[model samples]
Target chain A: MNILVCVKQVPDTNEIKIDPDTNTLIRDGVPSIVNPFDGYALEAAARIKDNAPDTKIVVLSMGPQQAETALCECLAIAADKAYLVTDRAFGGSDTLATSYILSKAIEKVEELENEKFDAVFCGKQAIDGDTAQVGPELAEHLGYPQVTCALEVKSEADGLHVYREAEDGKEVIGVKTPCLITFTKPSFDPRFPTIKRKIAARKAKIAQLTAAELTSIDPAHAGLKGSPTKVKRTYVPPRKEAGVVVKEETVEASAHKLFDLLSKAHVI
Target chain B: MPNYLKVTPEIIAELEKAAPGRVVTGADVNPDYSKDEMPIYGVRMPDVSIDAQSTEEVSAIMKICYEHDIPVTTRGAGTGLVGGCTPICGGVVICTMRMNRILSYDLENFAVTVQPGVLLQQLAEDALKHGCMYPPDPGEKMATLGGNVATNAGGMRAVKYGCTRDYVRAMTVVLPNGEITRFGGTVSKTSSGYSLVNLMIGSEGTLGIITELTLKLIPAPQATVSLMAPFEDLAACISVVPKFFMKHYQPQALEFFEKEILVSSEQYLGKQVFPRKIEGTDIGAYLLITFDGNSMEELDPIVESASEMLLEEGALDVLVADTPPKLKDIWAARSSFLEGIEEQTKLLDECDVVVPVNKIAPYVEFVDEAKKNYDFEVKYFGHAGDGNLHIYECSTDMDREEFKKQVREFLDSIYRKTMEFGGQISGEHGIGLGKVHYLEEAAGSVNMGLMLGIKKVFDPKLILNPGKVCMKL
Candidate 1:
């Protein structure tokens, strides 16, 4: 069965800076990193290829020119091939637009490979956005049954069985072939790219596609213009004020102060 | 270059047949599997993720990968420093998060046996419940024991207790060929031939994947006290470190921070740790010292004398604080020094340089001078008592490419100076992707060649975490 893994390049949250005067995200100089959640998704896809030797795992990502780094990283991890959807028109796309564009990319990838994707794997959500709407939305757009919060998956000839986490505990669900899944944390651990693979991935060619190249989508369906949510403002939360330490000489008094603080925070 | 190993559909069918309920394929693969704690990097979602509950499943998966020549990467809690946990190659990712059950805990032997996916914090808390402690605390509470062992992580307590390698008594490793082997035991010492356990300690999952670990433990101290000493001069503060060691006053932890670090830590923690604000004063650095003993009576006198000595040695004042919460706060600040540094700087790249105790002062001086010459800002702080100083370099003004280049040059200068003074490039943080060049420079071609040979011996197929430590394996 052919598998298609969707990945995304995002700004490093740790490196993200906020402008003091404007209270907006400062993107300048921030290192671009693979969305952490996507590692699990990639690992899942790789595992399938490992078990099913004939299974071809193709990676798909969306971003600017720098996003090639993310695709290169995918290749380094052992993905057979990688494609990047980079178009100026696709810039600033939100979950809805991003999912629509990804669906189109997957369709194009299938055409290029001369095969239909049996499954499309994606991270539950990107850390920067944390909207978590893309995976489910993509499934809806593609008319595929989706198993969100999927921790484990067992693929069979007829369909795929998944273990998904829920509010109470876990639920096992079965979906027909060509389904979609959004993985949750602690579901399956991601792997480290070996030294040999790193070299091969570095030399590997990442196929880049533009909006016009992938699909005949209207210009309004991509980029910032296509995104529904607009950022009115972004600001750093105010620094927490230091708490008053009840200068107590004994440990008991200090413990009481801590308990009081915890109570005030409604943690206790 | 050879896709010589053919993965037939029949073999895939066989694997699915063997693991009837374990295999996940297709779009059912989720995106959460893509990345780790660091979300800045883009996501390369996996095609499938297998939640192996037993060693049998892991072995079966590895066997399949070996037969298919498919790349396999083992993951723990995904709390790796470098992108070690990220499947940059997009192969099979065997996740150990579900295999978190504590197999055994022997109180009499002072050892604990646990699955590789057990969280370090959970293990520590469990050990505490048994009236013992695991000393290799690497700040991140969510970090797994396996990840710690993979990196051979050293934390604040490493000054006294050493790193994870020191406590790792044994490990159950899954070889590249899908063979399971146990190296070392619960014994305190080992003279066994070819210490594979030590070899696997910092291999970063490149050799064989660790499934379970037998970790040595120590009796937790009953009484503990913390003291913050503010020094008028940075050199004066660092100069007193050797004296403390020479005097035979063994401290559990001895950490040095610049005034900026201390102030930032205070702001981060939102509490007044020092008696007063030494910021903008002539005082340039502060040393936070901690001592733990079986009893308060035994610790009090040693702490008093140490305080008196610190004052005599140019310390402005040595302030003793209460135990438990206050002590935890001081340590939290010291432990969060890296985060504090990242919060203050634009771009942060750290080098964990280890030199002889005497060379530390010179190394600090050299790095400071390099900053002045290179026109950059660098911060110096770490396990001062252990001679492991983390020199953080950054460009407060330069662009991305120039910043990376300058940081590399600065690192080269400091690394060269460290080598001249007989030092290792990295003290703790293993060579993931960033420090391969420095590892080559420090270890030289001959030693590096031997390491590659060892890598070949362990992972003949080179399917394990490759391109790390010694690059281009």
Candidate 2:
């Protein structure tokens, strides 16, 4: 079986700083990382490959040249092949246009490799934009079924068994081959890359695809011109004040104090 | 033994006058004030405890204690491993936790003056906000900066940046007689009179109480990368430590631990960050190293060459942790080693001994051989770069008293061997009540006499943290 995992490089949110005057993100010294949820998505694919050694995992990303670093990381972890779909025409694309371009790029990738991907994996949402529309939209564009908020995935003789997070708990669903899955955080963290794999990843050839090469993606329906939404402005949210800590000699006393305080405040 | 007056209601009234609403007596005093992290040494509740908020308050409290001839124990967060902050004499415990504050910053001199009660973690984080760093990174982040200075704490970064003593530029201390004085200053270099600041450091609260501190800070590093190298066994892993220094790798931190300890730490953390097997070979030990610099361009070649050298020196594989989360995962496990050991063991005792860098392998081997003669399980890890090893002897099956007796014998053997190897019995932990005998044995009478004399001069009544450090009582 072959899988294609989509990843994105975004500034580490914990280290993010904002320019007070411009009310915009200060990206100068901030470090970029593979979106954490995308790492979980790749780990989900890697675990499947762990069970079936013959499975080939390919990593795909859409961004500027620096996005290749995220792809290389995926390659080092488990990916067998890497592709960066970077083009000036794809700049400023919103969720709708991104899913459309990615759907077209998937076809191009299939033709280039001469193999159909058995499954497409993606993070449920990119942390930076957090639109969460791309994966489901991509599945709709490709006319394939998809599972979102997937906590885990297992490959069996029947098909892919996906345990998806629900409002109450988790619900298991079986999807056929050629399906798409967008993963959330699982119970386990992704494994660290070994030195040999890290060295090899630095030397791995990352195939770059441009707008012209993806023939199915029309120039009119790509980039900023095709996007329906635009962010007018951005600003840092105000930080909340530190909470009060109640400590008594015993747990019962502490609880009583908390209950009394909440009742006095009309919160309980 | 030194005679000391008990804390009477009159003394409590005097303390309340100095630091109103902060004094507690009898059952109202916090039980934690009776001991530090290590209760194995001994514990005794103070007759009175006061949370001092300033140098004046500490001085006033000391004046009352001094005139009444009460033994005063100064405590911080009470996170010390060797009972350094334990109020074992049942007099008065003057705690500095309430004095938590960052006093000032002299950017021109690259110094930040802070209240000793401020936590190490608080200062470390606050320094980063100003593009500066407090370099002393002891494992116990919640420990007070005052306690760190009092113990002259040396941490993982001691390999590169030295210890808390290296960072301390100045401090305000209250003497036993309630005299407030300043030591050192914000100046970078000093050729002034007797180095009183140096003397007060690592005194374990026996000399005076540290109320305020001015510490040196450096510009934060632009980039950092950590490497984990697994070897066939501890000997092979540790054999590569000196080679890194010989090769001028200048690692920010260098640590080595056996797989068994790593397993216990991972189990404690509920996460496995390091691989136990690589290429079908079970890894018996690992060396965790870190390098920091202005840019990756400068560190890349160093990392590459170091990786090559480690592999050549019997390392099975070297793994890189360049990202923040990866670094946190590895370091969190490394820092929790003591807590992990403590969680599973009913009785525990450890020694933080510093030997010559070259003597680490042989000393560890000697320890391994010696532990076989005892029933308790032995586990160890250390800053391989500086030759400071934290060796712990623990047991779950033995009776408390039996474990204590046997461990005492075991430690006696260990410290004797340490002295023979020309090593110090206490590295960063300091000679608190727990290791006084070993310290006396290690330092001998002549050196011990000088230390005791200095204590007598600084604290003539021997009323400050009585029965601690060089004190025989």
C-alpha RMSD of each candidate structure in angstroms: 29.1, 3.2
Task: List candidate 2 stretches off by more than 4 Å.
Answer: A18-24, A166-171, A230-268
Q: What lDDT score goes with residue B104 in model 1?
A: 86
lDDT of 1 at A232: 81
Q: Looking at model 1 chain B, which ten-residue stretch has the lowest summed lDDT?
A: B1-10
What is the Å distance of residue B319 in model 1 from its true position?
Answer: 1.3
- Give model 2's TM-score for chain A to 2 decimal places: 0.91
> In model 1, which runs have C-alpha deviations exceeding 4 angstroms?
A1-268, B1-48, B275-282, B343-346, B373-376, B395-398
Looking at chain B only, the TM-scores across the models are: 0.90, 0.99
Per-residue error (Å), model 2, residue B118:
1.0
lDDT of 1 by residue, A174-261 (tens): 9997889998775334544533455566678998889778765667777899888887865676758887767566989988988898
Superposition TM-score, candidate 2 onto the true structure: 0.94
Query: Deviation in angstroms for A25 in model 1?
Result: 49
lDDT (CA) per prediction = 0.77, 0.91
What are the TM-scores, per candidate, against the unseen true structure?
0.60, 0.94
